[model samples]
Target: LWLPGMGAAYATAAPADPVPWRAILASWTASHVAHAVDAAAERLQADGKRAHSSQRLTQARLRQTLQRAESARTVRERRSGERQRLLAAHAAWREETHQP
Candidate 1:
């Protein structure tokens, strides 16, 4: 008998000899089970790889975000310092001009 998907043929015994139906069934079942296990293992491996890649991408994005935030904070601090210096100078100039 020809097994579909296996591409192999199984021959039956001569008319006088009994056919080994149990052996044929067992072999077919084992082949199908093994195929299923292999397929499951491959899927798990692929999923693990995808998860690892996603984790790396997330870490990179987080690092970039932190760097941008740090840069922005530095700029703000510098602007604040400049504003304070300008205000102090303006106050000094006003006091000198108003002195009688």
Candidate 2:
């Protein structure tokens, strides 16, 4: 007989018969091992999910950094163009006035 919540088995025998101790012990051991395996599988599945989530978060952060870098590059290019235009206008004015 298997006991609930005890993970053990018991056998009854008459005086002329011997209890099947080996079979009872084997069944109990198998049951405990199966439970342990199931628990380990559940933990691995949970860890996998966490790892996948972390990878997605890292990817999103990388994309954001790239976008910020691109924006800064565009701003720098625009400022450089403006500076060139201002210098050209100043040179033209100096030529018209013959300031050299």
Candidate 3:
């Protein structure tokens, strides 16, 4: 028999507990999902920084290539002009020799 505020009456337990296990599990899943999203965001930021660095390096390489090509073109032009001058001088010498 139970009495009010007595030892046996105070120890009475619920016939069926209303524990929300499903809600607790959902909360756990949401926490893990948030962590995963944060990790993905960090990885994406790192990849973006790396991509930007690579793009800058590519631009620098392209500029170096263009400068080298221009230098080569200038050298070729100078050499061609010198060759034409030499050919003209040779022709003039041949003409003077044949004129007696």
TM-score of each: 0.77, 0.76, 0.67
Using TM-score as the measure, the top candidate is: 1
lDDT of 1 by residue, 1-20 (tens): 55653333134323343655
The local distance difference test score of each candidate is: 0.78, 0.79, 0.74
Q: Which ten residues in a row have the lowest lDDT in candidate 2?
A: 5-14
Clashes of 2: 0
* Residue pairs in candidate 3 whose N, alpha carbon or C atoms collide under 3 angstroms: none
The true-versus-predicted C-alpha distance at residue 37 of model 3, in Å, is 0.7
| RMSD of each predicted structure | 3.5, 3.9, 11.7
Residue 93 C-alpha lDDT in model 3:
89
lDDT of 2 at 36: 96
Q: What number of clashing residue pairs does each candidate have, in the order they appear?
A: 0, 0, 0
Name model 3 segments beyond 4 Å from true.
Answer: 1-17, 96-100
Model 2, 1-100: lDDT tens digits are: 5555333354432334365655566667777899999999999999999999999999999999999999999999999999999999999999999977
